[model samples]
Target: MRLSGERLVEYGEKGGCFVKKMTADDIKDIRELRELLEVGALKILFSKNNKQTIKELELICEDFTSMVEKGYYGGACEADVKFHEKIIEATGNERLLQIYHNSNIPLFHLKLGNALSHMDDYKQTDVEHRRIVDYLKNGKLKESIDTLLEHLDRGEKESIEF
Candidate 1:
């Protein structure tokens, strides 16, 4: 919420646009946010740590995949949003969830418009999601963090037409 889309465009117009090279603290904050998003995206996309949630997310992913296959990108975008929301909710981190829900979450979902437009590239994201979840399952926090960063960067890139 700190920066608007028009503000971002203004920065681009002035050639000051970039997600900017993330600083250590920036990266730390983003990594924290990404962890929450990845957890949600993966939990909803592939279902991990809990069977019921997994089944539910699998069904949603299947439906969203079908929609994507049929060229209904909006639904895919919505499912992606729901996916992330579920993860944030699962975390029980109210403050983090607020940031995600109010700002980054919408931006991320918006990027899915581009990602779904280029399904092949986005497919890498899907696989990355699963990998992140696998890392979480195995208790590899660092690996999960790395993959989550990659996942977020990919979305950030695509969001700006990368």
Candidate 2:
């Protein structure tokens, strides 16, 4: 049972994160919802909500930067995918998660070896991520969000200038 004031941090670590073993009580079914959302994102239907998408991405990058700054490589997956999962959550894209859960993960993990080699870039990434978070927390949501999306795009291309 979840006790009062149970923080997620207690379930994991201060800097490094882990996948907690789960039971049926912790699971929820969302196959259809995820399929629908994935299809929408893939088809670019969410293009209309571009601004919202950007802000969410910023939040993601901030988390990545934080973990890296703490001297941890982050999580079980590539930095980009792990970071994007955070973005997906902030977007409240329930359906999109399904797609991540079912497909994107494998594709991303396949390239994780290369991503691990880029761990040294964590320091720079951390600064960029922190800037994004400051923008969001300080009401510069639009600018921060745009920066976030651009950061992700750059990471995907492995040509991140910032």
Candidate 3:
């Protein structure tokens, strides 16, 4: 977990290791970094946007919806990660992709810490996901980015509350 950058363990000043409690500040920092990388890559994603790309995102959205309906919040979180990842990977920048994975943003959003994994309302998320894909499919970069920001902001708020 430490090697994965999940940082589940923290070393004490005296050299003993123990579980690290995740704080709101930690979640804020991770969310902000995620925003930076994801938002920065939007232009590249727009450039590479295509029907196939949109379809892939749509499929992820379908999976997310299905998971939410099944009451599998963990699977829904996984799908959420995949949706954002698909957008980033669409940029075709290997370094950016590697950095994104190394940053452990996906794990942060997953059930490991249970911070953002238990969002109270999944319907809003499903709608937001579809709206984003619709904006992308219609070549609305600004709208898509705005929706993405809103989506991320909602998750950050929920994570902080958790």
Candidate 4:
């Protein structure tokens, strides 16, 4: 027996599913999740010696800088996502990818976009991102991880204040 579309629609209608509004605690949790994911990804990427990864990160950093320069703050936020996503991909861990995917990244991007819109020195962000790439390129794992965490921390603070 095959299920009809109308029956499936009726079944779905009867089975309740709802989207909840994000609470303050939820926002805090997302921020912490982002920190953990980004820091862990950076640690993993730092452990590897991949010149190609560094080059990709450099390209993403340049794209972010260009986006900010053009006042495309939303595009800048997307570039920021791509920057971190590349780091996460470099880790080469499937579970980490799953965790990153499960997080509320779109909402995080929205908050980041809003924060970037209010910032006076967007170039400072580009500099921080470039510093991270520089550290990774130079094979400075400890410095790279430290810089990455600091960058994430600043983002968290800005998102919270926004």
Candidate 5:
């Protein structure tokens, strides 16, 4: 796991495995990597077909909003992952998608449960997700990426504090 760059786990030479504690720095590092991959994918997505992609993301945004409004944070997290994954998938680069999956970015929500515990943040997340989809539909790549970074940064802050 160490050789593969899995930060969540560590295997001791004494023949035991342990769950590695996540520090604030570790969360920050993961957030930075996520930003890089997601921003790069968004740039690539702009060069390709986005009509279908926009619709898919819009549907996800709706679901995410509904989940948040209903106070189902777990479901919201899943929808959040779907929304971001759709953006990455629209890039049409299999390797990029694979790297995103391997990075386990989706697990952050679970790992930092307190991050999404606030209703205010949930509402903000919904609004941000809708804005991202709208920006993409309007051919505003820069705005979409900017909103994405803002969204990720908010989560990172909450995670670190938690």
Candidate 6:
């Protein structure tokens, strides 16, 4: 059965049938799987004609940046999830999208929120996200991939510390 967005949020906040507190190993596995999926999604995104998707991504990035600037960490995290989910959708790969949807997105968001709450300077995040958008928009595949990797790496480290 598919989960509604509200249900997913419930799972993330309160735990449910498909949600549980992640162990260190589970976190590691999730990180690895996320990296693999994102890399594949990026490759697919690069090959596709996605002008609309790029525009949407740009808007989301701007929204996220604004949220960060206003000290709205929760809003920023929501925008962050939407940005990544949009990338996954832009891949135009049904299986990849399904995998990401089934993966515990709410839990990932919770971890991300925790990490972001601990950070004082969100400028790095804003810059990196903008760079990813620029790289993708300009067809710089390698640079986009590298920036995405670095962003994910930093996220993983922050999550682990939380």
Query: Top model by lDDT, which number?
Result: 5
Could you say which candidate leads in TM-score? 5
Clashing residue pairs in candidate 5 (N, C-alpha, C atoms within 3 angstroms): none
In each prediction, how many residue pairs overlap at the backbone (N, C-alpha, C within less than 3 A)?
A: 1, 0, 0, 0, 0, 0
Q: lDDT tens digits, residues 1-162, model 4? A: 122321211234667533344455655676678778888888888778778999999999989888888889888888878888898899999999877876656555565565567545367678788999998888887787778777766766665665
Alpha-carbon runs more than 4 Å astray in model 2: 1-81, 105-110, 113-116, 159-162
Model 5 residue 123 CA deviation (Å) reads 0.6
Error of 6 at 126 (Å): 1.5
Runs in model 4 deviating more than 4 A are: 1-24, 119-121
Q: Residue 87's C-alpha lDDT in candidate 1?
A: 59
Which of candidates 2 and 6 is the stronger one according to lDDT?
Answer: 6
Ranking by TM-score: 5, 3, 6, 4, 1, 2
Candidate 4 displacement at residue 146 in angstroms: 1.5
lDDT tens digits, residue span 8-93, model 2: 22344456544333232221122233334433442342334455555666656665666555655634234546544554554566
TM-score of candidate 5 against the unseen true structure? 0.87
TM-score of 3: 0.86
Clashes of 6: 0
Estimate, for each residue in 1-162, the C-alpha lDDT of model 6 and write its tens digit.
254543432244465556345566666777788789988888888899588988999999899888888888888888878888898999878988888878876457556664667445366777787898899889998999899889878777766776
Query: What is the lDDT of every predicted structure here?
Result: 0.58, 0.47, 0.80, 0.74, 0.83, 0.77
- The weakest ten consecutive residues by lDDT in model 4 span 1-10
Error in Å for residue 23 of model 2: 37
The lDDT-based order of candidates, best leading, equals 5, 3, 6, 4, 1, 2
TM-score of each: 0.58, 0.44, 0.86, 0.78, 0.87, 0.81
**Residue 156 C-alpha lDDT in model 6:** 71
Per-residue CA lDDT of model 5 for 1-162, tens digit only, reads 653376667788997877677789888988998899999998998878579888989899889888878888888878888888888889999999999878877676465643457888778888998998788889898998999999999989988776
